[model samples]
Target chain A: MNTINQYYAGLDMGSVSIKAVIISNQKITGWALIPSGGNYKTAATTVMTQALAAAKIRREDLCGIGVTGLGAQSTPFDARPMSDISCQARGCHVFFPSARTLIDIGGQFTKTAKITDKGKIADFLMSEKCATGSGRFLQVISRILQVPIEEIGELSLTSQHPIKFSTNCAVFAESETISRIAEGAKPADILAGVHKAMASKVNMLLKRIKLAPDVVLTGGGGEDAGLAKAIGQIIGHPILVPPNPRLTAAFGAACLTMETTSG
Target chain B: MDTQSQVKTTAVKGTDTAREVRPMVKDIYKAAHEARENGKKVAYMMVASHYDEILRAMDIVPLPTENYAGLCAAKRDMDRFLLRAEADGYSQVLCSYARIGLGFDSLRKELGHIPEGSPDGGMPLPDMMIGSSAICDPRFKWYQATSRYLEAPTFSIDVVAPPPQADLNRVRDYYINYQKEQFQGLIEFCEKQTHTKMDKEKLWEAIRLGDKAWQLWYDIDRLRVAIPSPMPSQDHFSIMVAGHYYTGTQKAVDFYQKLYDEVKYKADNHIGVIKDEKYRILYGGGLPPWHTLWIFNYFESFGAVFAIENVYRGFDPVQVPSHVTDPVDFLAWRTWLRATAYHEKARQNSGNPTVEKLLGIIKDYAIDGVMFHACRSCRATTVGQTHIKTELGKYCDLPMMQLVSDMVDLRDYSEAQWKAQIGAFIDALEARTDQE
Candidate 1:
């Protein structure tokens, strides 16, 4: 537990993707995101190796490791399991020090947390056991619309009349999207509607907790410009999206290692 | 994946006295079964019906169905009944307690006896039923539905409290008078069903016993105001069985008296439910998830002890006076006062009654945060919890979170999700405390 130029690694073993980030001298040096698939331990190791390789550091060189997300418990890593809410708050705050509110849209769940000035979570609100407001819902729609996940944001932005989805349930929304397709609706319009539905769901969660200034969106869902735009429009405020938003929690996990090591 | 099978029951008792509750409840059911075998009349009653004393006066075995449902849920045996009720055309959205009761009755009729593995020897078929809609309409209606299956005469009483904004001085007499009339009707119904005259002396004795037990219970509950709470809310949920289900009986009185002494001794010694008490939480209103009572211990792992719960606040509102010699009048007055006590206190504070009461509890208990379990099946508990949480946020600087799940429905809950939320909440509470 050296407090010098010690390296720290954080792995976020999320439901949809395993994310890893390496930090040195209080800065993120390398990051990796890979599909979690079915084996969390393998995913954790693979992502960690890639992130370590990118950072040009050996595994033994790391001073500490922090793990987070749904699969953190089972991951084969000698790491401290931190709540994703805490990690997300710390990571978002490091990128934007003014950030007081953070909305992390992970694969399966969306969480909204209030951050203190010192990069600590003050409170958090999680989405119920539903996928309509999550990245999985977006992924489901991507497969149905035959659109690449990466292309969804740009494609959805071009739509003028978004198909109005009737339900906020992920399963029901899938059928609704199919019905819209059968009705000869454009894919971009349907994707836009999906964004609106997702944004509306996130807005409901945001409304439940106290909304503060400098709202930052992170996690896989943060990568979608269409969703960010829709959420921004709904909340009547622009949201900050840092570079590689999905790595924020992993980065925060890495940053927390600094504190753990220094202590 | 059957979430039902995934649920594991825990035996961690919050207090030694609380350990007596399940056995006491089981013995009540056993007594009811023996009562039926011995050709004695038994009455199915709701927990908050306020008529257990009358039934006790008449020597009618009072089987509290809601308490039984809670026990079933706690034992993780409720899904069989719940699923049966769902199969019998009852909506899953209906009150889970009702579903369990109706399902139990339906299954008993089908099998010619209690279901194979009913917890505490399943509730005996009642000869009579006394139902009240004081808390919610479904409570009485649940009994009425059960009557259709069991053929037991069901008497439903309406005991609506005046609105929180109502001027009690103007409405108190009317409500008490109405409630007294309802009790009279209930007594006549019971007397007719049992073929016995109303026993005035016995009723008085029952009332006196109930009052004594309640006072002792109140003293026991107030001991939680001590820092490093001697008893956690999980223990209260168990220990409340006597006051809730067996009130007016000597057993209930003796139980409370013993519990009061035990808790008082602990409070004096500054003994806590957990050794290192860090965060003191106010269980801000809702029926707890009975199946996952282990969640209480999980919170304990984070050095959090639920100091008090407002859900089953059994003490008589001291501010609301009751000075009636007549038993019926006293019950009516007590019922009305208990219902409006929070609102009456809130009017003086000029805020939402539940919110005001919670803020006071937070202060009195030195609470660090609040956890509101929003049970989906029970609207009476779940509806305004978020509003209270929001109001608490506006009024106090404390960490609060709403946990949404059903008290009895396994399908509506996820332990992983709940534990995650609890972890985050405790972390936030610690961080906030550290900063302060």
Candidate 2:
């Protein structure tokens, strides 16, 4: 049960996945990610159980829990729900204390938050009425190209000549990709094109909030090396990615849980 | 069923002003239908202009395009009409209100009758259309396009923006003269179309009635500054439709008077719009999504009430001096003032009028947080919103969040996503309050 020290947990029930993190003595002890699927409650329970086992801590030792993301409110947990914007800022601040800008590309939406040196969110911009620069877009293209989502990034990096995608819409882009494939375009080229489009859209959001130096990237889309490189190319600067980029929000939630419990 | 009876039967619990406002809106639609059947002239006016009084004075029925668009959106019936307009080569990027109105207009023209499933048997075709250069460019094009299709005479009032440093009083005469000449020209145009001369006495009466109604509306809104805000902005949204289209008539004056009485009653009894109100919020930008107004209920569940909305705040006409006696001059003053009041007020407060106005509202209403709708179709309102949030951060320490959705299109809205964002915002507000 590891009763020698107190433990705190965070659950981020995002649209595409359920993420959980366990922290002890201000350090991340364990984290887990599982597809959210249709039933978020079940997914959250499963992920939290896996996270606790990985941390080798009993549920009774947890002092508090914090939740975030789209499915945060509905999670069946004794946790305080927090906005992803604030949690993302907190999570990134832990990794890069100088980070003044944070970009989170999740499943259904992409958000850019401007953070203060004190770890507070100064302002934010989010994708609206479209999913052009979100993880869902990348997943859709992966299915069409008959490639695993994780491998699309490595494959894209190998392209010698990338095709240009004219549309930013996910549905329309799928048709465009299919047609390009029919015309004998290489898979690497198509994937690279998708990455470029995603980067351009994300760059627009960043520009709106005026990207500050020491920008941090997180969320599911942050795992894609091709997209990260594309964003860096578009902005002409390096971006910071946390060690556990996809689990940052959950980690932030754990931090919040610890703060509130200690207080 | 008659509107009054329908309102009494279907009104939601605890919203008296909304119940009263619904019947008045229905009556406007009914009048439009009757005017068409009786062969009387009807004119379409954009929401940006303050010309409803002039039309009503000449015995012309005024049909506001935005009001009809709102009705369609509230009923969730905009899909068919919007698709119809898009099919006819109208770009999808055009405002949804314009798309719906143009689609309905085209369908009515083709069918030679009110199309099936039209909202309230469709709006009557206008014999004339009036637009202004005050708000957005698309409005000008919208009126022009519809005027061409209906073969109706269209008159556009050119409203020049006041200079940043210009004294409104010193430059007032120039604008008044220019607007007066245009008003005279419009009267002459209407006289020729209807074969009737404008009666000076009737024009004066309409102006006085409209001015009285507006003053009362302003007073009613002031009551909202009370703790636990007596009414939600949704009620104000419904009532403003009457203020937009029927302010020149006794019906609208009476509506406002009754609304004022009810709101005052709530204030006296300390009856908050949301029971046990925990938080008061200011809706800082973009228009309310008419399709899912139950979004208010979502906030209500958390004991939060939107004390005021930016659109509703801007809807009030600027106060005209009591000394302006000439009806045309008064109308001119109102037209200019209504067009530029929000911006002028912002400038008076120093930097970024929108941001200044919101900060002022937060203090006046004791706002706990701010929420921006970030409507997808409205560029004018949605633009600079993030900047406004940033600017507001410099002035006030309140929590703010932006919810991205379309103004009228249901397809662009995801209830789950909206709920998630709203829930998160509420949590932020609570966390801040606890820290304080």
- Cα lDDT tens digits, model 1, A86-183, are 98988988899999889999887899988889988888899988888679999999999889998999899999998888888989988988888899
What is the C-alpha lDDT profile of model 2 across B19-63, one tens digit per residue?
Answer: 766667777778987997898988887764666677888998888
Give the B-chain TM-score of model 2: 0.92
Question: What is the Å distance of residue B387 in model 1 from its true position?
Answer: 1.3
Q: What lDDT score is found at residue B227 in candidate 2?
A: 77
Candidate 1 Cα outliers beyond 4 Å, as residue runs: A1-4, B1-7, B314-323
**Colliding pairs, model 2:** B346-B353
The residue pairs that clash in candidate 1, if any, are none
**Isolated chain A: TM-score per model?**
0.97, 0.96
- Per-residue CA lDDT of model 2 for A118-163, tens digit only, reads 6767666677758686889999999999999989989999988989
